[model samples]
Target: MQTSKVEIEVDTQRIMGTLASPDTGVPGVLFLHGWAGSQERDLQRAREISALGSVCLTFDMRGHAETLSQQRYVTRGDNLNDALAAYDALAAHPSIDPNSIGVIGSSYGGYLAAILTSLRPVRWLALRVPALYRDADWDVPKFSLDRKDLAEYRSSIVSANDNKALDVSRRFRGDVLIVSSENDDLVPHAAIASYRSAFINARSLTSRIISGADHALSTPESQKAYDSLLLGWFREMILGAR
Candidate 1:
């Protein structure tokens, strides 16, 4: 396999991405990181997936890490735009098989992935602890969770929860996977449950909940479990395993 660091221009900004591919030219998988995450943070998982014979491209979301700018992380739509732009860049790459594109997103990225499936020809989607609903119990900073901000967030959450985008997913048609942590504190189980309900009702969807994992799934045991589940799912769905 070969690995390279690349950047694609989106609007006036440049987004950083890492590409890993097998020599045999397999399908491409795009990984979108959550809020404040960087492509480097997902290198381990990207390399692991690449070893399974699929190209993996992971990039930083707007206002995070290498893509960070003066712009604030204010809304989901902005992040979704970044993800779409990255997808366009990957699709245009000479080595990638555009029709076989898959996406895996974590947290905020997971929400964006679900939304993107509605707009793009995403063959497969894997959402890890996705923030499907904005729960009041989550520990958001007071300044960021002010009334005006809260209202905006609530609007976005409601719009998404109402299946406005999932309706689009149903129209586009694709396989869907939802992964959740049973003990996630930051994003409550109820939120993931709501997302699961919405997804299942919208189209064929599979879900798995890690018994003891948290929102980040940062522990060694939890991380390993997530890796195993995700890798196996990607191999089967994107790599054509029986």
Candidate 2:
């Protein structure tokens, strides 16, 4: 196994990531950390996933980590572009097999991953407490969005046609795994149900909720459970595909 640092240039800002590669001609997995989270959160998991005969890339999105200064100025559009760039870079890696790609995201990252499926080729997708946002503020700074309205929007039932992320979920034909926290205050049950209803076309769909877990999986037990669930799903989706 080879682990190394990588830089992805997104316009003027440079995004950083940790890449774990086993060998040549293997599948690739991209890990997108949530808003206010950094790539370090996914590094260990990326390494473990790579151990399963695949290459894994975990990157820090704009407005986080080294780019913390941009937190107040970054928009969803900017982060989406970062995700695209990271995906492209992983696909172009000499050790990766472009035809077999998987993406795993959490919260804000999950939202971005859903949209990415519509724009890229993803054979497998795993989302952890995927979030939903109103399309009215596509260009506004993420931090500036109204929390009250956003909270209300998430609590209400939304159909696939009415939400960008859910809309892509409806069209996605690949394997999907959605992990939700049972006690997540931020992502209500209504939001999860909306996503469940939207994946009408997914090749296969699996949903799991960690008992007594919160949005962050703050407890050690919850964290372990999440890791196990994700790795098991990857074993089925990634290794089984081989």
Candidate 1 stretches with Cα past 4 Å from truth are 67-74, 133-172, 201-204
Q: Candidate 2 has which clashing residue pairs, if any?
A: none
lDDT per residue as tens, model 2, 65-84 = 98899999999999999999
TM-score of 2: 0.98
Best model per lDDT: 2
Candidate 1 lDDT over residue span 26-134, tens digit each: 6778898877777876788889888877778888876778546533543566667778888887787676777788899898788778778867778778888775534
* Residue-level lDDT for 203 in candidate 1: 36
- Backbone clashes, each candidate: 0, 0
- lDDT: worst 10-residue window of model 2: 16-25
Task: State in Å the error of residue 20, model 2.
Answer: 0.7
Every candidate's lDDT: 0.71, 0.92
